[model samples]
Each structure stands twice: as structure tokens, then as C-alpha cells.
Target chain A: MPGTADEGFYELRLYVAGQTPKSVAAFANLKRICEEHLEGRYQIEIIDLLERPQLAKGDEIIAIPTLVRRLPEPIKKIIGDLSNTEKVLVGLQLKPHH
Target chain B: MQEKDDIQQEITSSMRNYSDIDPAPLEKAPTGIDGFDDITRGGLPRGRPTLVCGSAGCGKTLFGMEFLARGAAEFDEPGVFVAFEETPDELIRNAASVGFDLAALSAQGKLAIEHIYLERSEIEETGEYDLEALFIRLGYAVDQVGAKRIVLDTLEALFAALPNEFILRAELRRLFRWLKQRGLTAVITGERGAGTLTRHGLEEYVSDCVILLDVRMAEQVATRRLRIVKYRGSSHGSNEYPFLIDRGFTVLPITSVGLEHEASDERISTGIAQLDAMLEGKGLYRGSSVLLSGTAGSGKSSIAAHFAQASCARGERCLYFAFEESQQQILRNMRSIGVDLAACLEGGLLAFHNARPTQLGLEMHLALMYKTIRTFRPRMVIVDPISNFMSLGTQIEVRAMFTRLVDYLKTEGITAVFTSLTSGSAIDNLERTETEISSIIDAWLLLRDIETDGERNRAMYILKSRGMAHSNQIREFVLSERGIDLIEVYTGPEGVLTGSARLAREAQTREAQLDRTAQLELTRVRLEHKRHAIEAQVAALHAELAAEAAAFDTALKAEQGRDARFSEDRDRMATQRKKGPFAARQGKGE
Candidate 1:
């Protein structure tokens, strides 16, 4: 999804080693959450460390399937498969109260 | 490594012949640290992970860093440093403190440093994950430098960053396997856990080789020690090797040096000629250890200074370690004894390290000495008043330090002169230190204060000399401006005499000889005088008899004439010759 003109935009980067189950599930879970919350204003970039292994050092990546929120005042990171959507939202500052 | 290469060649030539080659020994990668490779026999098991665990600030990271640095610099092997605790810049700065130029090594493409930043506060873990990013980073770092050695410094930080131990453990196992698969020698450092070798029990995972570093602070003196808890495939030094992280990792496995050094029969001077005569007609053996035991103010320093100056005169470097006095004080005092150490210092053959023994732990002192010896390459070393080190540690520890020191010096073929201050009787001091340190000492010279006739004089004798004939006579040594003068003690009828007692006996003997000579001369003069007096009396008697005979002759002639006249004038002249008959009788009777 690309950012829209009329609203606040959300740019996210998902870093993964390869197409593991966790990577696929994290991409799917992240897309689903953005669609329900800010479908038109959110954009996601997928970086496979297997293809661009050098990119891992720049983003300080350790755990596979790590989602880094890029477009925002403060860059935030949420690791794992994003199986618990509520915790993922809390980690990305999407739901501040939680 | 050579064996591995030979085996590789053998395998290629044998072409699957089963009985052609023997079972190959485990190959090792040498760490290039002094005494380290010697103790390990080889080094860390090649292509395996070696766990180096220790408490905080005990030099685990430094050990790992130096391993990589030395590999990259000396072994021509590229290394990767995976830093989990500090950033690459921080690592560079830390390495710089020890004189390692990490940035230069990195720029030369011989080393790579990867900083892995993990904070539990900055990220959230919602589901299962592995440390694939770490693996990828390490792999990339390794590939970037074609590394043969890698250091995962404090890899236990992942336990704090990630919440799941199961995944971390599984990933760590995979990582070690991955490292082995790549055929890279690795050193993984971990923090010491509560009663465990490592915080995350890393030793359990990396079982091939495990090293433990320890830092102990005793009496405000800290010493860093290293020990190989277990090397799975290699025999290593089992003792705790005292190491110094100055400039680099210097592991002095002094105890394990063994008695492998060759004994040279060549003797070197003790600088005092008479003392040399007292000690085997020369001085100490070239590489043997000599113990000079004495009481305070007993010229130990003077003798040691003489040795240092003598060494310099022979164009050999001599390192002097002064524990009780400053360099200036030693130089000044030695000058008073006609030993000018300043000239030796100016000649650049004599180096002095004057410090209080309490300034550092016993092991640190040994390390410093070892370092100085290695750098200075002194052929002779003098430790002035080694007993001052007794206040630094226990007697046993001090003895241990000296034992190692003696072994190290002997192995290097350096002659060592150690001066120890003793109190009470010289015998007591010798007995105590002889048992404690004589095993290390090749010669012992006991300097004692002989109290006789209300004065204390310094006397020296050889207590023991292992391989040479030494004089057993106690020499009363005096320290004058002309230097040490060894005077032979007198053992006359007045018993053993030294200093003023011998002088007094000599004076008394000389006075008795003078009295006897005067009496003999007086008796000869009296006898001569008596003989002369008797000769004079006989002459007088002879004169008297002659005079009397002449008078008698004259009187008789007058009497004859008077009788002739008396025939005419009645012998008037015969009255004048009244003494004639008395004279004639006297003459005839005589």
C-alpha cells in the first residue's frame, strides 16, 4: 500500500532472513492490521536479509521477521511473527493506551 | 598445524589407503601470546568455539579482542569481532588503549568489527523468532574479511535482549555449528554467572575449549589471572597463569616453565674480587640464582650495586629492581661505597625500577618484571632487598613469586642476584629463607653482624654453593670509600678475632717483641762494660807494679851509692830509699 495525500502516512519496513513461515505470517498480519486501521495512509517495505544481507547491519536487526516503523517522529521496532495483533499495535505506537 | 598439513599431503597421496596414515592429532591455532602457546602446547582447537568466561572487568573482552588482534596482525589470519556489549567505535577506542590499532587493521581488510545492539526496552517480541539477523550479520562480517578467527564478545547480552531462552539456546547451538561448518576458530566471551562458568552457561555449549579469567584484589592490590579450565583435545598448563593486559595479553605461565634451561658452567663476577674469591674463585654461575642475605645497613645494596656496575662494565645489561629505596637514594648510597650507578645508567646498560612492593600485587610485580626483562633483555638482574616484598603478601606467596622469577630468569639464562634483609641471628634468617627459597637459589651468601669487644662488624660467609668450591672462612667485610674490603678473620690463641680484637692482639704481640729486644740489648752493653772495667784495672795494676819496680831499682841504686858513701858518710841517701825493701818485696810477691 502507498501513502495517500489527505491523511497521516505510515511507512514501515519488515526485515526478514528468508521466506520462512514467520516472515509470511508477519507480512500478512501487518497488512491486515494496516487495512483495518489506516489502509490508505500506510506503506510497507519488505527487506529480505538473504537478498540484501548488508541491510541488516544498517537497521540493527537480530531477530528474524522484525518490523521497523520508519515514517514517524520516532522509529520503533517490533520483533517476532506478529501473531498477537494487539501487542504489535502497542509496540508500533498505534494503540498508545495499551 | 604442520602435522595437519603433512596429514593432508599424506591423504592426497595415499588415495584411500586405510593403513597408510596414523590417527591425526587435533590441530590448533596458536594465540601468539607469550607463555600462552607454550602452556597450551598448541592453542585453541581449530574450527571450534572456545568459551572465555569471567566476571565483569576480569578481561574476558580484552582477551577476545587481543586474540583477534594478534591473529590479524601476527598470524596473517583475518578475524571478525562480533561485539554485543560495546559499539564498534567503543571497541576501537578500547583496543587503542592497549596499543592495538583496530581501525588500521580494519582498513587493511584483515579485521572486521560488527556491533550488535540489543535492548529489551527498544523492541517487542510477540511470537517465535530466531537470531537469524545475528547469524547473517556475523556471516557477512566474516565474508567481508575472509576471517579465519572470530570473537563473539560477551554473546550473553542476547539473554537480556530477547525474552525466550529456548530460541536463544537453539540459535546459539545453531550458531556454533554454523561457525564450525565454516571452519572458523572462534572465541566467545560470557559473563560469569552465579556459581556457573558463564551467565548463560555458554561453557556447556562450547565444550571443546574453555578458559576462565579471574581478577583478585588482595590488600588493595589487584592481579589478573588466567586459567584453562579445560581444553578438550589438548594438554595445557593447569596452574593459574598470572597475566597482564598491558599493551597486550601477556600470560606468564612461569611455574610451567620447568627446569628445562641449560646450566652454564661459566661464572660471572659478583663485582667484589675478594667476595668472588670467597665464592668458588669467581662469582655466581652465569645463569644461576644467588641469594645475598644480610641484616639492615649490612651493605646488601652496595654489593648489588657493585654487581650492576660490573655487569655494565662487561657490556651486559643489568636490570635493578629496588623495593625499599628510591633510585636517587640508591645511586647516592652506592656512590658512597665507590659504586657509581649513575655512570651505568648513563651507559644505558643498567635500568632501575624502584617501587614499593605494596604498590602492586605479587603477581603484578612478577608480570612487570617479566615484561621489563623481555623488553630490556638484561643478562643480569638484581632484586635489592627482596624481603621487603614479604609485607606485600604472605610468606608463601612471596616465595612463589621468587620461585617463578628464578625459573624465568634461569630459563632465559639471566643471572639473578637477590638481596634479602634479615633480622635476629643470621642463622635463623638463613634457616627460614633457606627452606623457603634455597630450592630456587643456586648460591647463598649470608652477611652477618659480628658483635665483638663492644662493636658490631660485618662478616660474610658462604652458606652454600651448589656446584663450586667456596671458602668457608668468615671474612669481616668493611665498606670503605674504596669499596668492600674482605679482611681475613684471625683464629689465633685468642680465638676468632675480627676488626678491633684482631688489631688489639696484633698491637700486644708487637709491644712484647719490643720489650724482649730492649732487655737483650741492655744485658750485652752491661757485659761489655764489665769486661772493659776489668781490662782497665789490670792495666792499672800493671802500671803500679812497674812504677814500684822502677822506684825499687832507683832506691836500691841510691842505697848502694849511699852504702858506698856511708862507708864514707853513713848512708844518708839510704834514708831517702826507705821504701826500697817494701817496693822490692811487693814487686817480687806480685
Candidate 2:
């Protein structure tokens, strides 16, 4: 992927409760998706609500293992462990083949 | 009250069943609004959510803000105000007008104001949003200030933002329950529905307390009233109370507890001596209300001015409310009658509040009066020509306002005098204002213009003086350059004499008395001459009778002597008869 300085960079946040299996799996899957489809142009942040429960209201988070896309205009939220790579890629608006 | 006790028992017993922790019945938080705490007994239910519903411009937001501000300032309870409609800056500015410096409170860490903007079309709700975000924000704000009071102004904005009504209802219920569980007194304001307590029917869920504020416009006058719709575990005033948002939210409950005001047997002068004399040689009770009713030019204002002046003379603060005249005009007129209010005004013992009845609604006028009384703390209050207020409100509203005013004055042990203007000749007919308010007044003085012989005279009479012996005589008084001088009872053959007629009758009586005195003096001289002539004639007759008696006695003596001489001549021959006869003749002569 030929990425411009700002056009192709992705910012994603994974919100979860501690080191739960679902939260761990969701973080790993998000990292893999970003590396395969748009490496070197993507940034990933993991947030454990157990440590910062006060931040749950900022993104309107109720359930754990939620992925939120913050950059590139319109925000989107998806709830799951991100086990299905194709579904995760589709939700993030990436090519399924990646 | 029973319900409250039962709730307390239930709470205490239930706590005993649970853990070792004791749960007592919830106490109330004072609102700090004037007369509001009295009506609410204590105030809003503590650790519970209260729903305040009102239509547009009915002062619901202000009420909620006042509750929070007062709670923070007076109760030492820090508060958090979450506005769903107005921005925090706007709210701060708005609150500043009512003398509440929200910004300062926030800076002191005693109050926290948060604005949550929710646009209905900008958002999409996907699944299972339980308002935890809102809860977290509120909790964060509360923790930041350690707030004990919370206010959510206009909750309908949140309901409008959400798409699903079921979810909104459930979420709102949970929100109220959560607030109650958090043990903070929360005031939730909402828009009033057409025929329901709130547009969202929130009253059904937030059942701890519900208050309704209504602003009604009648005859182009707007009056704001507040009523407590329901308080689950407390007994509260159920009647609608007039409330105003002047410097702050104040609810004035019109109904007094009862007729159990402290009695002040002390009497204060009515300013007119004759009028006071008509009131059983005294004035009015210190805490009583005096109603002075009269027709135009009957000197009602003069009497009121005199009363005010007298009150000032006693070194008591007097508040004079002039509805018909300006302050300058009243002062000028009163000065002309030798009632100089300027000295009192300068001495700070008297305050003249001049207001046009048409300028504000009746309740507004009442609120202003109450506010002034509260600020001035006057010992005496005078309303000149209270009948002029009749033009501003209905009879019922006017009566209610007057009743409340009188009751408040009585409660404060302040004397009050109200003047009213009637229509016809004051003596012939009682004005509608007088008849209606006479019962509530401690003393009712009617000033009438008695038209006799094409001349009008002013007459004053006490219609009623409660708890005192008052004269039943109508005293005709004249307003002169000195003061109001109540003339003595002057009744010609026609009727009571007033004004020039009283003066004329007084002169006539003086003339009649003088003329009768002169006539009696001439009659006394004639009777003295007749007595002297009769005494001379009787003395002459007594001298004539005495002369006649003396002459007859001399003649009888001579006869006895001759007979004795003859007897003696006979006795000379008879030897010694002459000596006895001569002694009898000498005794008869002596």
C-alpha cells in the first residue's frame, strides 16, 4: 500500500476490562489486521477500563472487547473479540484479501 | 403524618432485617426560599429524586438552580448541576441576574455545572446503551466537588435525543433509582404536558416528590403559582402558592397556619384624635390591620398619612405604599395638611413606596411589597387607597394578596393600615371593597361625604374595631392646615354635619346658646322687680293692721277702768272693792 502522510494512516483503540481472554484476543486480532492491510501507517491503542473506568463514558462504552476507529473522519464502533478476520477487516473498511 | 411515620418504621425495620447497619428515615433539605421551607415543613425529600414540571417560562429552571445554589450556599451541601439544554456559560450568566454567582460557586469547588449537548439527528443508538456514560460523567462531576445535591434541568432533551421510548423510559427509571441509591438529593426539571404532570409522564416513576409550577395569564396579567403535587412520605401545603423569581426563587404560601397570631394589646394611634376617640379613646392594636374606606376627597390619604406620621413619631419604622399618588405628590399633599413626612423620611423612620397599580400584576405588587417589608423590617405598613389595586386584579386575587399581606404583617407584629376609595356618598353606601375586606380588618373606618343643604361635609365612623370597645358615633372631621381634626358629633335635623356644615352648625349652636343666655338674664331682671313691688305692698298692710289692733286694745282698757271706777265708787261704800278693781284696770292697760 502506497500511504500518504495523512491520507492512509489509521488510528484504532481497543477498550476492554483487564486481561480477559476476550480483550486479549481482540487486541491481537486488531494488531494483526493493521499489520497485514496497512502496516507502518496504522496506530493501535489498548485501553483497560478496569484501570480507567472513568473513561468508559467518553466513548460511550458499555460492553468490553470493543474496537473504535478514531481517525479518518466518521467514527465507527464494533463489539466482539475480533475472531473473524474478514468481519473485522470489513468493519474497519479494509480489503478482505489482506 | 401517619404515612411518614409508617415509612420511617418500615425503613428502620427493613434495615434491621438486612445487615447490622441501621437505616433511619430520610430527613429533608431546606430550599431556603422565603416561606417555602415553612410550607414544605422542612423541604425536599433528602436522598431522593424530585420531579419539577412546568411549562415554558414558568421558572422551573430557575427553581432548580435556586435549589442547588441554596443547598450549596446555605445548607453547606455542595451541588452538581447538569444542564441538558443550556450551556454552562449561558446558565452562569442567567443565574447571575438572580444574584446567584454560579461561576464563583464552581470556582470554590462547592458547585459543579456540566452541560451535555445531545442533538437528536446527529446520533445513532445501536444496542444496549444503558446511559452508563451519563452516569459516569455525573459521578465524576459529583466526586470532583463531593456534591450532596444534584440538579438535572430539563430532562426532556435526553428523551428527545434517544430513538426508542421504551429504552428511554427504562433508562430514566434506572437513572432515578441510581440517583436515589447514591443518596443525593436530586431535582429533575421537565416540561409540563397538556394534561399530565410532565410531558414524558415522569411523575409516575419519580414518585418520591412531584412539584408543579404554573404561570397563568388572566385579564392580561400573569401570575406564577407553585403546588406540591405529591410528596410520598411527608405532609405538605396542598394549596397553590404565589411564587416569584425576583432576586431568587420565593414561594409565598397565601394560607396562614391559622388565626393563632400573637396578640398585641398595645394600641397605636390612628393619627386622628377624634377618630381614635371614636375607637373607644384608643387607636388600633399594635399588630392589627386598619381599613379606611371613603369616597373621593374624603381625606382617606390624609388619615393614612396621619397614621404614618404617628407611627414615625413613636420612633417605629413606617413603610408607606402609595398606589394612587407619587411619592412627591403625597409628600406635598401631606405637608399641606401639616403631616410632614419629610422629617420621617429624612430620619429614615419612614419609607414611601410609590407604585402604579397598572405597572405590574397583583402578585408582582404583592411580591414587591413583601420583599420591601422583609428588607426594611418596618414596624408599621400603610397602603394608601388599596382600592386602586382592585383595577389590577380580580376580586379573589386582590383579596388573597391583601389577606396574605395582612397575615404576614400580623405575624411580624407590625401594624398595617389600608385605605380604600368607594363610589357614592360615603355614609349612604358601603363600597364593595369595604364589605369584602371589612371582616379581615381589625378596625374598619369609613369616611363619608355627608351632603346636606347643598354642602358636602366629611364624616368618619368606625365600622368595626375588633377586640376593643370603640365608639359607635360618627365623627365629622375637617382637614385643616394643622392636621386632620375630627370634629365632635354634629347632627342637624337632616343628618350628620361634615366639612363646612359642621363649622356652620357649631357656630349656630354657639349663637343659639349665647342668645338663650341673654334672654334668661332679661327674664331674671323682670322677675326681681316684681318681687320688690309685692314686698312693699305687704309691709304697708301689716302697719295698718297693727295700728287698728292697738286702738281697739286702748278702748277696751278705758272701758275696764271706768267699770272698775264705778265698781270702786260702789265698793267705797262696800269697803275695799275699789282696790281690786283698780289693779285689774292697770293690768288690762299694760
Off by over 4 Å in 1: A1-7, B1-24, B256-261, B392-395, B424-430, B452-455, B490-505, B516-590
lDDT for position B338 in model 2: 96
CAPRI classification of candidate 2: incorrect
Writing each residue's lDDT as its tens digit, candidate 2 over B1-590 gives: 66435534543443344332225665899888787888889999888888888889999899889998988898899999998889899999999999999999999999998777665543433333345456766888888899999999877887787666776788787888789888999999989775566677666567677788889886677889898876766789998888888899888766754577899989888777777777777778899998888888999999988889899999999999988888999889989999999999999999988988877788878878887898899999999878878777677877777888888889999898998888874443355685457778888888887787788778888888899888888887788899988767677685766666677788989999999999999899888887877787788888888888888889889989988987775656345435466655555454
lDDT for position B572 in model 1? 31
DockQ scores for all predicted structures: 0.74, 0.15
Docking class of 1: medium
Q: lDDT tens digits, residues B288-407, model 1? A: 988888888877888788889889999999999988889999889888888889999999999998888888888899888988899999999999878877777777887888888999
lDDT for B373 in candidate 2 is 90
TM-score per candidate:
0.85, 0.77
